[model samples]
Target: MILGTVLGLIIFGGIGEFSKSQKANSLGQVKYLIGVSYPNLNGPWQLQMNKEIKNEIARHDDTRVIFTDAAQNDEQQVQDIHSLMSYGIDLLIVSVDNASTLTPVISEVYKKIPVIVLGRGVKGYDYTLYIGSDNQLNGNMAAKEAIRLLGNKRGQIIEVEGNKESLQAEERSKGFRETIQRESKHSIIETINGNWLKDRAEDELKNLLKSGVKPDLIYAHNDAMALGAYQALKQLKIEGIKIIGTDGLNEESGGLRLVKQGIIDATYITPTGGTSAVQYAIDILHKVPGLPKKIILRNHEVTKSNVDSYLTEGDNSSIPFIKKKERKIKLGFAQVGSESEWRLANTDSIISAAKEAGVELILKNADYSQKKQMDIIRDFIKQKVDVIAFSPKTEDGWEEVLMEAKNAGIPIILSDREINVEDQTMWTSFIGSDFVEEGRRAGKWLVSDSKLTTTPLHIIEIEGTANSAPAVDRKQGFNEIIQQNSKFQLLQSYSGDFTLDQGKKWMKQALKTYGTEIDVVYAHNDDMALGAIKAIEDYGLKPGVDIKIISIDATIKAFNSLKLGKMNFTVECNPLLGPQLMKAVKDLENGIEIPQKIITAEETFDQKQSKKEFSRRAY
Candidate 1:
């Protein structure tokens, strides 16, 4: 078949004279050639195929094969095929760039040499053989699995098709739609094209979200697309969306590894085209005929329960050591500085948590200075710490420090303050509260509990550190809620820098400025509220009597003050880091990967609830 294709190419003047001359001269030599569909080397599919092709070539003692990446260009692929044929390659393997556009090229090559097409098959052409997984069946399997895991509910499913122009993508969507239809209970609310690239898939998914399409289950044609969809869900702040995809490669790392880590629900097996193509090429070289015209590998679904089966010890293992080694882990911490009571509590918790976890902690205070934090990080590098943990003073200045740590092969974990680092490759993970959500909860509680009168209620806010992430996020969340209710008006605002003395100083100033105007005081942290209480009492205003109080960071002092009726409401920002920090460090030491962010669960508390849960509170 390949010989016929090559003859057609020669007759049509597709092959250059130089190629023809080479074909005539190298007729007796053992030559092999492979034509790949896309030139993207970073793509998992391309990398997998490259590995298998190289392995197959190494197995043959007298064979030499030249590889050509068509880079998803049809004309370039046709030219590559002709050049390969001209080189007198004994076996020709081709993965089509475009199934339809490459048909003529495949037909021409098939006339001169055996042509085995990899991945998506070409139409209007008969070849020596075709090898690829049944994409449609894989898609159907993914839908079925998603339905089964989702209890066959009638929730919306979003199908992310790869390269809408590609035949495989069309087939996959068809099978998925058909399967959902047959299930009767399942529904597909929307479908978007991912283009089989992570960045493009994420952008498309984001656009879909903006259009008000909320998907319960996101099914992508490939793992890369699935991961992209997951990222979109995270960015949109949508939770409980189950994601599934195809290509069960390695579950311990890469896309499959993410699946095992509970990032995605499952993945279906779509055998790498490279392995089968190379195997078939070798068979043809040995004069094997009557090979299957179409080769389809069985599809296997990989879920969390069975993910470990696909992860070999050597393949997905994070730690190479079989036995536990007693090595000291030098740790560096760049705190948000002692700005708020919560910040101090968080810092103290980290120190205490490390001591309890048995991790050698090398602490550094950024002094709320980004430059100082960067310098501290450099010091940590000089100390050669095994791991570094930091709560960046601000979001932007840590890139240099992060790079230095990265270069030194130190894994960094973020805590408390969220640096504006978008690169997931930089840090191992983050562990802290969802500051925005925490603020939202605080706002909702305040709005729900406050007594509504005909008069607009006056509120005075004592904010934490002005530049800190939590302060910004908490303020934003509070404003978002307050804006929804016109009855609630912020009379005045002042930053106490999260210190008791500053809070007292600001409260005194506010009292002198807005005498009887302030009816309620909302402090970002409890310590600030405690200080404000002293000022209120000093001004002959009875605590929790003349003006109600609402504060966050339900520390022990905050709870105790609530019991004394000094504070009206205290949102629980449990500072108990022993359990969570220990778990994170242990996982890292054991070479077990953790999630990118670990949000500590929290709840709101008022005087009534605070009294009931105070004794049980660990922090």
Candidate 2:
């Protein structure tokens, strides 16, 4: 890895150089010695992180930093951590040597000094805080960019992975494979363990070429391995293959330069999060509250288009402050119970996004009860939080509580479901799906399908909760579309209560009445459709064929059903609206006008095509 070559020099040059760099600070009485340990001194990521740490310490006159390089040895890293504490260091910063064994040592160290772990995270322990980029997002974005470049064509991908023990290796690998699996035209022919090193990567690529396995692209975990892969390809007289990698290190030999020279096609700028780590460390030293237990610094993309601009940019300068001037914004949310797969996934998105944004979220589950949701919202108003958000179970009964919120001058964001409110000024915005459009899309797909057209169709509708906006709007939209078709017959329509059991029971009765006469089943959402599929199977009828199944809400359960050829189609009702909600909150706080309703994007999915994206499904 280029990162390795850049940073490795620091270790071989000797640790004395570290002391010389901090010589000026030695004159002052060291109030604190923040012990820092890195697993690998050879990588640029480690080098940059440590440099930022020292720079941050340079600003704090009362604090000095002590450093150690484990040289990728887990045992040495563990031992170094102990000795640093023995020297009476006030705290420890560890980028672990090994994610597994080193966790025990880290856990022990935390009992003494507050631990701020970076990069290679250990499992089964709770340290003070973890600081790093979301490696999974890195992998995911790389895969998507590669797919875009290789559009509508078959390609062989040679994946070069980081060290197996590293968390980035697991997350990046998973993200890449998950998306690649869904893109049928592309395949990972083989994965070479690069160990985040350049020489190893070169050797691996050379061997692959010698074996006559042609690769269309090379994907490395870091810029060094990517450079190695590019060199090996050049030596073999192979050209025109796109090479993708991570760690957008902006140096002569790093990703930015390589990308500018057209050596690497693209790279994800995985921030070292060192500056944030130092800032967080300072916060702990000052006993600041409201700092998150974890901090995931954002990652960015680098390509040929703006490589020069990126290269020109300097380091993020610090305006050091003992305490941040802006207090943490508290957000309150009333989540609907995990009644279905869609609801569960929505909750996950909100929680993860809030944590990442460093917003203090006061969350409550209403368990799909109107009374409970009202109480939750009322409590949020009482708490006087800056912003309040919720996904209501029913459209009714929110008017009173929403009015109370408006009276207190707190902005409200109605998530997923918009309620029956008289005053439009009561809520700031609605961030969710356009249910009516989702319904129309589903109906249109059924109407346009070659198999279902020109036939007298017996359609059985599985309605959701009686008064839910999704249920009512979806039914209305379907009715509006199918009303003109005389051949389309409503065989038997009833409420399934949006429950799997109820759907099964209703379908069982429908089966007894219609038998194979039921040609189509339009479920309000995926859960009911999944339930009806079970009921269809129990009656010895093959779903997606003898009786076509169509539903809304493109969730994991729905995807699995579609993949198995058990469900015919599902109109996507996307639930991952958390990031947008956070942005809206920030915009509102800045006195910017947000739209009254922020309608989310939706898509259509069929069994054959939806199979391609099942691996990438978050829910």
Q: Best candidate, lDDT-wise?
A: 2
Worst 10-residue stretch by lDDT in candidate 2?
A: 316-325
lDDT comparing candidate 2 with the true structure: 0.79
* Per-residue accuracy of model 2 over 29-85 as CA lDDT, tens digit each: 446557787887787767778777767777776666667777777787777777677
List lDDT for all candidates, in order.
Answer: 0.72, 0.79
Global Cα RMSD, each model = 24.7, 16.7
Please list the residue runs of candidate 1 whose C-alpha ends up more than 4 Å from where it truly belongs after superposition: 1-326, 339-348, 615-619
lDDT of 1 by residue, 453-558 (tens): 6577788999887777777888887888888988889988898877889889999999999877888898888889999999999998987878888888888788
Best candidate (score: TM-score): 2
Q: TM-score of each candidate?
A: 0.51, 0.54
Backbone clash tally (model 2): 7
